[model samples]
Target: MRQSSAVFRMIAPLIAVGVLMVGCGPSPAPNSAPSLSPMPVPAQTAASDKPLRVAPAPSALTPPVGSLYKNPTNNRNELVLADVRHTAVIIGDSQAMPAGSWPQQGVAALGYKLHVAGMGGTGYVAGNGKTGNYIDALQRGDWVLPYGEPPLIVIEGGGNDATQHATDAQITSNADRLLAALKTRYPGSRLAMIGTLARGINNGGGRRTEVDALLGRIAAKHGVPFVSAGDWLTRYDAIGDLQDGVHLRPAGHAKIGVVLAQELTALGLAARPDSAPAAK
Candidate 1:
């Protein structure tokens, strides 16, 4: 499917984020809104390059500034705003593509709507010999912020770049440009970065590790939370979760969702619904 370079679109982040998966062939589902799903946990697997991060325990994080209140309509014990005003803007390449909607479950957990946009074969520095890179795509307005005012933003990429042997400078410069555009568009939103996925673990080894490190440095420079996938293979038992090494199987997708939800909770990005009351 060839999209006009001038046309910008907004789809629920992973509106199915559907089969738009890079390696998997197919366009994303046409739906423009994301679906919400609960998060979960993955049975333990061999330790990945990075030790498996086991949350010590579920502790309530401090509320963001004001007193929280539970939405009277809510069925669970929680705190936050009653009505949802925030959106989670997620962008990436194939990894961000459809294989599985990695953002839906976690975004739902945070009570924010999800919006995703990305070219299946594109990334910051590579495009699988097709499509434009993230920087150019954003510059050309291939897609824009669909969710009105997003409180949280996530940028996922790097796999294609390393596989295609993108120069460090190319990756760095393009990544910088992409981040600039995101901040410019959603100045008030909190941002986070998810790095390259690996094959064995440690980002599938080789060049991917370098790419993850580079992306991490960029994230650190920008002061946004960064989730590295260098050890993802072992951490998530990716060998069984991946369908083709890059795209995920259903189980892989579920594990990723749970892990991401936990990270967002830890970051205090998705502590409670918008309507939950502040702790006494």
Candidate 2:
């Protein structure tokens, strides 16, 4: 009994010393919300009490309709929209200067005002079945051109030439001559051509189609944009806009006006009236 009591006493003192040593060691770190985690908080403000800025989302502006066109007849790019502030000159046959004034209405919307020089029987050429070719008429002082050498000059013919059976040679010669004369007359103004109307989109087979093709070639030679009105009407599904497949009804005239306006714009021909070229 005596020996057991002594051994227990010695072991008790050593166990006490070990517990005291552990307590003396550094205290355990406090239990924090796990080391990796943090609470979300509102962004801090500057001394001026201004809110922190966040970049605005990206935005893009789109161009307006009729702002541009890839000219179907020539594969050329044209600007169809611009300030409606310039004067325009239009030369054509009966369709252009029809009995009613609707077609010209739309053209007039393109600028400050538009002028037309045309007669029902006149055209780009005369011969087999046609007469009063445009070239001869313009040369003889037979036609009146207002606002000469304006910002935009549009020459449209060949309808009479086709109907009257004007020969290809005559058509080409007269068209070229007329183009040259216009260039000479309005050297500073931009020029464009509008081809003849047709029953269908294709240049199927006939004098009219041949005339259209011929005129297209001539326009290309002149480095100008030729709006194949036939194709244009077909493209816009506006065949119904015409009456008798040749003349434009009021609706047709409106369509022509809108389309022509766009074409003129696409060519970058529209400008402020004050910027237009002065009369020769």
Candidate 3:
């Protein structure tokens, strides 16, 4: 009985040790919380709350033809003569008063009465003097008739003078004296002296350049505008628009008229349509 009891004790201890080993084995690592990785974020887009959205691309604005007249009182639709007593004067040589004059066309288009006092063959020096016999019809009173109010005077000489071998000093001096005299005669008038057209041949005389330079100086001295007809006309010629080698064709004249009208508007000689607001 004692021996049987000892064997029983030893077997009991071995069974107890096996149960402990089974309990100590890994139990799914204690069922720990799942390790989560960081989630990726989405990209952002532009957003606006405003109702009125701006255009991606905008277009440029263009001004109307003959819409640059600087005159505050003159209306775009109405002729200057309808309101004023005197007429605008255009003085030039034959080319200026061509078969169809650009000045005349320009004035008419811009709703103005035209009074041309140009002598075809006369130069600035000759016109101012009685020796040329060009201004014979104009009496002393008529000399200042075109200037009671500030009139738009288009002076278009220099072509003849330039071609005639006039010296730079002579040309400038003549232009200066003439402009001074005109200013003295008519203080309020605005003068625009058109430069001479280009003569193709180099006559060894600097007449063409001299006349242009003098016109610029004269314009500065008189505080008036100077338009280079030669420059503009040459551009036209480059585009194959000249009838003769020298004179402007009808289309050319019209182009010149358009340019002149724009110039007139800029000079404050014409009025804008929407000058005064409506009585609302």
> lDDT of each prediction vs. the true structure?
0.67, 0.66, 0.57
Name the better of 1 and 2 by TM-score: 1
Clashes of each: 24, 10, 10
RMSD (Å) of each candidate, 1 decimal:
32.9, 19.5, 23.6
Scored by lDDT, the top model is: 1
Candidate 1 on 157-258: residue-level lDDT in tens?
888888789989998898888788777655666788888777533334788777888899998987788877666766777668778867777777777777
Q: Which stretches of candidate 1 lie over 4 Å from their true place?
A: 1-84, 128-130, 200-204, 271-280
lDDT of 3: 0.57
Ranking by lDDT: 1, 2, 3
TM-score of each: 0.63, 0.60, 0.54
lDDT of 1 at 225: 88
Arranged by TM-score, best first: 1, 2, 3
Model 1 lDDT at residue 8? 34
